[model samples]
Target chain A: MGKVVLVTGAARELGVRFVRRVQREPDVDRVVAVDAVEPVRGLGAASFVRADIRQPSIGTVLAEHAVDTVVHLDAQGAGPEGRAAGRAFAKEINVIGAMQLLGACQKAPAVRRLVIKSTTGVYGSAPRDPTVFDEQTVPGALPASGFAKDAVEVEGYVRGFARRRPDVAVTVLRFAQILGPARESPLAACFAQPVLPTALGHDPRLQFVHDDDAVEALRLAAGEPRAGTVKAGTFNIAGAGVLLLSQCARRLGLLTVPVPLPALRWGGGVLRRAGALELSAEQLRLLTHGRVVSTVRAREVLGFTPRRSTQETLAAFARERGAGPLPPGLLGGAVDRAAAVLAGARVRPPHRQEAERND
Target chain B: MTDAKVIPFGDDEGRPRAASTDRGARPRHRPSAGGRDPRRGGPPLSSVPEQRSEADALPPGRDAEQQGPGRQETGRQEPGQGGLLGRVLGDAWDARAARGLAFLRRRLTGEYEVDEFGYDEELTDQVLMSLLRPVYEKYFRVEVRGLEHIPSAGAALVVANHSGTLPLDGLMLQVAVHDHHPAQRRLRLLGADLVFSLPVVNEVARKAGHTLACAEDAQALLTRGEVVGVMPEGFKGLGKPFADRYRLQRFGRGGFVATALRTGAPIVPCSIVGAEEIYPMVGNSRTLARLFGLPYFPLTPTFPWLGALGAVPLPTKWTIQFGEPLATDAYAPEAAEDPMLMFQLTDQVRETIQHTLYKLLVRRRSVFF
Candidate 1:
């Protein structure tokens, strides 16, 4: 508990909040915030180091810090782009960078807990059917950017390392779409539309974890006594509320635009072959079929109690950004557009149908 | 793929009747050759490379049979029946061939039925009991209880802890349900996916009607109102080493309960005594499995590559007992969605199996067939 904690990619929004959370936690004595970008202003006396985790020398620098709890949040393409660049960057930072950091952490005797902030995208895109994807379900990730796949590979390494060294608690927290003030999560960009796009007959099951809860889980993971992969091995951290894309658009008061065409089954293949996309069709399938990772493991293992609801998360972001109300016809526009293609197709809410039992 | 369908050598009646005098004749070919036929039925020499002699082809018993007479006293062989020498050589040879073929079947195809009992008999359980009764009466005693625990008719989930060395517990439970229980029924088991994937395994597994181990498969079987048997312990519990035998591992977040919760079938917990000690798994080589993509490399005493293969299952008198049915209709389908509830139920089933194993083990007198 007296050891120093180093959070990579600490200058980013989620990374910064994580550093702040670690700094606030009673167990953490010192935090060394490391990032390739310029250090954020006013992060108060907490040590700051500027170094890209992808660099080979970064491990030596981290070892020099004498830091123990290494919370790796460093990754690339944390922004929207035309696939290739995003994927290359994500692999470099999340996968390659993580391995570099992990290699260093393995050498450092002081490092007891290495908490890596992974995405549930590692779980892959959602499924077409609304089945609750628990920790038990095998991860069938979508082809989006290579971020999820890369992060998942890193997680496998982390799990293997944890198994090898029971002394160091290696925690891989798979978070949902993280959204908060100034945070540029995929969800933020996803909801940043004047006309929110929607998938027809597919209301992807999404898990949105607030930055605060996300950090709290990391803090708890860093402090827990047991070191091995906890619970279903991977915990699905979501916010208090679960909502579909259409519902989110409705809540945002944004204009919904539904394409009348069938689900974009061939979009990923076309884009990848054209060198415009990095994710494969399987990866896209992950996106098409959303996941529901059971949070029971998190709650039981880490005693996780989420404070912010999905509505609260969006509203707080809106309030902080001073964003105005959503357009009135946003939701109806998409529904009307979808209905125009298939007449009499009911525009029912996604969660209206109860989760059917496999029976 | 179709090559998997070739009838086993012993079962090949379609071989030209004229060739029967040659390799087809029971004990004739062996003496003509040097003690054993080099052209024995084994995996294609291409895959395995080593073609063993009659003595070396099979485990020891095979040699004994081949060394003995396989021809009848009348010097005549029936269509199905084998003479004294034929019984010894044929049974031994067939069993060896079965073992070799079963192995190749598992490796190539990935499907194999792991029968807890020796074989599937068509006769009624009472008839089976009548056959075993003489043996039971001569060497050991038999008893039964909890006949009412089984359902009269309906597809039920017979959830049981599987761990009688080579799955003897599963066989006893099948027999208990078939003979002792009020409603005579055949239990369709949810076998590991590997059982169906392996070549020869697929044949035996399909014959036994054991499907892949998954909630979807279990639910489908149960939806049709078939008696489904499930071993929640999976590989962890089944493959537990000898020292840790009978100590149940965590039942993977109760897919069985979820299956029942989804299908509204009553989960009947079952316990079979005298299975764990049959041939305690001394060790399992995971390294081999990783290399072979198999679940584990089980190393049991009798199965030690080269030795007396028929280490007769310590026919430790087995008694199967079915516990009260745990109904799932009360819980909504979404109720199965509750991870906590699933975990709790999984643990309950594990405990029930463990407690039963301990009781059964205590009652067991010795280990021998």
Candidate 2:
């Protein structure tokens, strides 16, 4: 029962939340929060270790603390800086940091469990994907670059390490586009704007998991080994059902700027420069034929049942982000939001599950 | 890095029929979206970001109580619900405050659900198929020969010969199956990448449950016991000159037979008599076809000359005949692997359909009878 948990990327809110969450477990003897930068948020009683996980120093920190479990959250999306730096920085931290952390976990005898947050982007959105992707659905097209590619590489390392450490329980949670009150996912950030860009012909379906569910899933994956609990495997954590891009844009009081595919690539760069969007090639692929993850494995293997559905999670994020602090000049964003709602398209809402008698 | 080629394009060669079918199937959806369907081949209009009142775009008839799943069903808002002034004032207050009501207002008002395959059944039935009903039932006057052959329930593979220069037969089959089946079953048509590659056609095809013509998708649907329709001839049967109508091009590796054997679902051979006469592809321009990214550009008597009016199909007095189900339940699931059996079964289904087409064509029935 003496669990010493070390959490990486503890400077971020999601990382901080994991640190605090692990600390509350009665069996967890100590919680070590490590990050390259000092955390601005309060960490309660958890000890803070300031070291970049990419450095070999992180291995020493793991050994010294006798970390029995390592929750890796350092892999993340791009930063606020220009597109080039943001992508480069994210790659270094996500791939390199993950490799170093896995190395440390491999050497540390005390580490029994490793839960690293991953994404469904590893599946790679394509026009020809299997209708539903279980964990085993061979990723149709591997991610080329951006956070998606980073996650793919990170997962590759994690899988490699799992083969070496037969004693360690390595769990990978491939989360769908996360959305919540202040849960800054790349997709969420896209919605943070008053206007959303979409591929002209496609209204791809989307899936989301709430922040609270993410926290719970992380904790469950690292929970003290139980007799009948979910075993170690890659699981997809997503809310049930999906929402269309048009529906999302309308719900957030935003105007959908339908851009043709040919012009979209150039437009993404222009918007990225103007501070209007985060238009990565990966994100654009997602926008064109949005990804949907099967939550069946997440439920059966990871023992998770999210409290919020995709619509609810997106609605909450839309609500919170729509109310975010903006300059007086951008108040017009609110009016446009309401007007889009008032003039929403004539598309009919889906038949309620109970009412879908044909199925 | 998630690279550029996610292999978004489906490589299923036989999925060629839906390009014509969906293009034909699209008349139901165009007028509703204010003509924004990118497949209509208009200039991609970049929505101008000008100083227009947001109110002009706000959707009407949305209120707080309608926040639940079936918000659109009940036409009237709650009795105590206020009007546009209340919403604008609430929105105004939301604008000033950090935690404004804007989020709640939008969140609670409208929510649309789409399935895993990106299909919106509510949209398909209410808007799409309904729009095509008059044209399908009246315009073509499509007659059915064997509605009784379709199983009222359970998974069955309905394999048909793909035809019509524009493949309007697929939609007619979908409508025929949907309208005439005793249990009111729907045919989940498997389309090729060509259909998904088009602009508006892709969106409508998906909503209408036309996915990639692949084994994985077909198996998943069959496992769930849903009826699946496949045009085994693909583009060869559809794009063949009118002279080759009903000849039944080789059914590519007998994929449908293998699919049926693997799933143990019965196979129903379907034949259409009049689709070959619809567009009447007398000739095709190779250069024009390459330019338009289409397999071939048809030179119909009226098309390219009549423009939009020429796009309309002639009332060919169509006839669809569904034959007896060829049982695959006798084969082991592993039987899908045997090439000899698959080849024999494929030829059997092909011969049955071809013979039936001849029989139907000769039934003292003229093209417009």
Candidate 3:
């Protein structure tokens, strides 16, 4: 009999894509999609179960479907909203949601495979990180706050669940900052801006994985039972090579404004208030000293390699941002002028909706 | 070295491979005789491919042609020049501002790429090294001996005596290896965390391929066949008092020896004289340095009293000598695990450098000569 697969976070583009991909597999019989909200559009022949994993009712939904495999992707890109209510709401959806889901997965004897879409952000960005973190580098600094903290908490709960259910083959994919068309990340938001704010005088190394590569890795992780020994391994997924923050901006035709670290702290507060930057203070460490994770295990064991290089992933974002018409050379001149204005004189760049000036 | 050949250059143009040098790092315009290889007398064009050692043949980020409308090419008169004032303006722009703008533009527009380790060959060559060139050649008048000790290819650990209050010796040694070595191989130096803690210094150090002084980083470089330089003395060597100038400090626990053994790279003992005399630290200001978040506040003879000029190093005649390559390849890889073997090799390398430094100092007639 074909296994019945239940995928969480069906509303997300990644979830929506995964459900469709998994449904096409001959080995997978039934695809049950679960989330708080229904996907705006149809997700193939998969049944959509409207339920929040944060609530205990998600267990009833899982039992009804007899989920043989659970693919958790809800918290992949959860950002803590600026307000306390929003933060609490995000936590409920992410941390509490994962707790509820894992509790259900532990009880469900039929669920033989569990795939959690985690991020490399749990490793945290710091001044003294290993040049590249492989599968085993202890996160030097665990994220103190924000959605990233939620990820760490979720992983901790997942680990707890793994110990309880040794029968279930668990695969935690720690994907690098995903960048591509249709994906939304703090990095993408920064690149989308005409003037990219960066840590002044620092060109921190950056790594990225394309949205497509992330989906492919997820599919590979999901197709485990039919293949080799279904071992539980936390895999770090990323494209090859890395780019400096400045280089990323340059490729996108976005102007880089290097703000002093102190001023940037202040600016970050202001940005949070204005709702200009979707990312939190902790995310700033990413721009200050960017993080890179190795895909060695993922490549060798999982049999996955990202088709896009970091530069190519970034270029996809640039292409999505519509970097044309101004011409690259002229764009460079404009970047210098903007930087000179910011660094030399305290030019209060109309940073929010600042593009209205051209109109 | 007479095998001159032009590299087949199409595949490496736009695609970022890995940089050996950048167009930004064009060798300075110096007159050369006909048929002489002008650029720093680097390895023959035939050897260039092998010497660069970048597995992927990525050329330095070449400046893309971005000839904007309304801006004429800076040089060469385009027939009808708009008389005297326009001619002067054009001449002035072409002579000075154009080159400066182009350089800045190239930098801003990503014409120079940094490696995964953060080494920017262009920045190291064009900006940092250019600033230090005059000081290397003229101010210090650095006399390099035993360049033959450095291997023309493959990995070698340069275990050098680290001295001088500000550690100018590291940059000088980098220049020494690049300019004097037959292959013009780059030196990847392992740096202490204190250097990386500073603002601009951290970025520049990374650009120059000076990563955190750790075994993981060092081994990775060695395995890649990079010439890795390590100053085992670290802070102690740089912070020593003027009285103990030539006395080499303790090479810490011989981490470098283990690294060499593991990677099977020969250790080249390097002794640098005259660096100790520059900015002589007569006393240490521990409290003040603590306030500054510095390892040691150097109380140089000319410093604190003479302001910024006090920070200026005295023009001392310098000598850097490289001793014979101590082969770690002879030992089995397991030797790296043996603390006893590592200690013996570390002490031997330290002693060789110290002896070389003493000999060089005693032969010197004058400090400033």
Candidate 4:
């Protein structure tokens, strides 16, 4: 018989893709998709459990379902709502919820593999040059208040559990920038907005992993049978190449305004002084030093390959609902600007409308 | 012979002393080079014999002298009698003839002896030091106005400017003291938390004896009367990009000065040159970095592995110059409490290093080492 998998936050982008990929895999017989909200669409052959994963009783419900591979991915404080909710909420959900899920997995004797989605925020803001962060680099100083509290609490629980339960294989994938469909990530929103120019050009390089690859990473985590602290064991799930924000903005048809580092430093200073941007003095240090992650271990241990390029991935995303004309920044040349207009022709609004009428 | 002079680089004043006829480190009149008579060179304790006699006994099975002193001797017959390549070929011929004789003696039953690569110190030091000099000359080269500022003896804190660039400045400083300074004292550098955590790298670093650049480690090393190095900027200075390279990052409330003030070690301001040009981080992606729990995205030329890991670090030349020591011994025990004094001292050290680096840059005629 194939193994059953339970995924919390099934509605979220990473969790949704996880369910889809698992269901397609021959080894996975069923995926028990859990979420706070009901699934808008059904996952074939997979059971859907709508419940808040943070609650204590959620574990009993998961145990009753006979989940064998519990891929826990429920949490909040990810998006804009993250800042509004006080520090305690971040700890309660990202941390407490994770602990509760692990408890549930332990209760369910059938649950063999527990895969937790971890963020690279644990590495903190130290400058490490040419040093590949593998399953060794510990989380440096906490940069921001929210990230500091959440990353610590989650790692602490997972680490403590790994020691006690050597039988249950636990994999914590510290993922880099995640990008895919249905991602209302702040960047995606930024892309959708009619910003003429992106601030601070040539300041930071970004790596984004497509949603499919993100799911593949989760699947790999489920298959692995190892019991160790795994340290950061982080991977740069970013898209195949690194690109500047100006380049991305130019490609996305947004304004490519270049805010030099000096100006930003001055502006940041003023903003901090004026209480416009709330960042600690230490946090500001990280703003100037660029962050880079190595995905070497992911290929070695997880057998993951990111198929989508940043350009293709962004193009597909730009086709999402109400994502009309390409932004001005993306209109690099006159020829490309014309091509972008033509690219919008593939939007297929008529086909959608026809399908809606048929339904 | 008169004692050899100990001159700090950028010390323009003429001083009289004996010059070394050999390449080896010569002794100076000042007693601080561990009070070992200037007449004697290296450690007085003879290096454990080339081959520990079997009958003389062993320390332990694992401690069977894993490669350092004995192995190097057996491996290389001093090169330049006919140069490195000529010696290798000559050795290979001898091995070949010996193998043929052994083959006949064993009636062709014996296995062939495998040749393994061994460490060549003189060659390695020459290559590594030459490769590192350019990086040192560009950013760290400083002018020492007074050679006498650094005491002839005891521990000293080399406080200097800190910049962003992954503590390349710190490493360059350590190499400078070893390679260029007259004393050739091995500067024990204190590293940040991130550096010690990396794999493969962590192994090489531990062998080099780098501990966390924490106050405890610095104090401990200094208390042993050894030179301890630190960069007050911590993460802040290291993270800065090329545009902000020389600009000193915040000193993190001057804890390093406090450490020096308490220890009574003179603070030696060290200026590092050429570290900034190694890699240029052009852009950062905060949104994406946050997803992965990282600080910011770095868009340097070789990184993001534009194909292979070899593209990681550009072999930039390094030059590090140590400045006149900032004396903290005269201060009262509670002197660390004076923030104004600490601030002034930090600025002075930073300015000195910065000025020295600019002067060094002017002296450097080329970009690549």
The parts of candidate 4 lying over 4 Å away from their true place are: A79-91, A126-132, A196-202, A224-236, A256-290, A309-331, A334-359, B1-369
**Where is the poorest 10-residue window by lDDT in model 2 chain B?**
B1-10
lDDT minimum window of 10 residues, candidate 4 chain A: A196-205
RMSD of candidate 1 to the truth, in angstroms, is 23.8
Candidate rank order under lDDT = 3, 2, 1, 4
Error of 4 at B139 (Å): 18
Question: How high is the lDDT of residue A273 in model 3?
Answer: 78
DockQ of predicted model 1: 0.01
Instruction: Give the alpha carbon lDDT tens digit for every residue of A328-350 in model 3.
Output: 66767765674454343223344
TM-score, candidate 3, chain B alone: 0.75
lDDT of 1: 0.57
Model 2 CA deviation exceeding 4 Å by range: A80-85, A323-359, B1-109
What would the per-residue lDDT of candidate 2 be over residues B109-139, giving only the tens digit for each residue? 3444567777776655545665665566557
Q: Over the stretch B106-169, how does candidate 1's per-residue lDDT look in tens digits? A: 2222122112121223222213333433333222223345546656777688877767445545
- Residues A35-71 of candidate 2 have per-residue lDDT tens digits of 8887759899999989988899998998898888899
**Model 1 clash number:** 39
lDDT of each: 0.57, 0.74, 0.74, 0.54
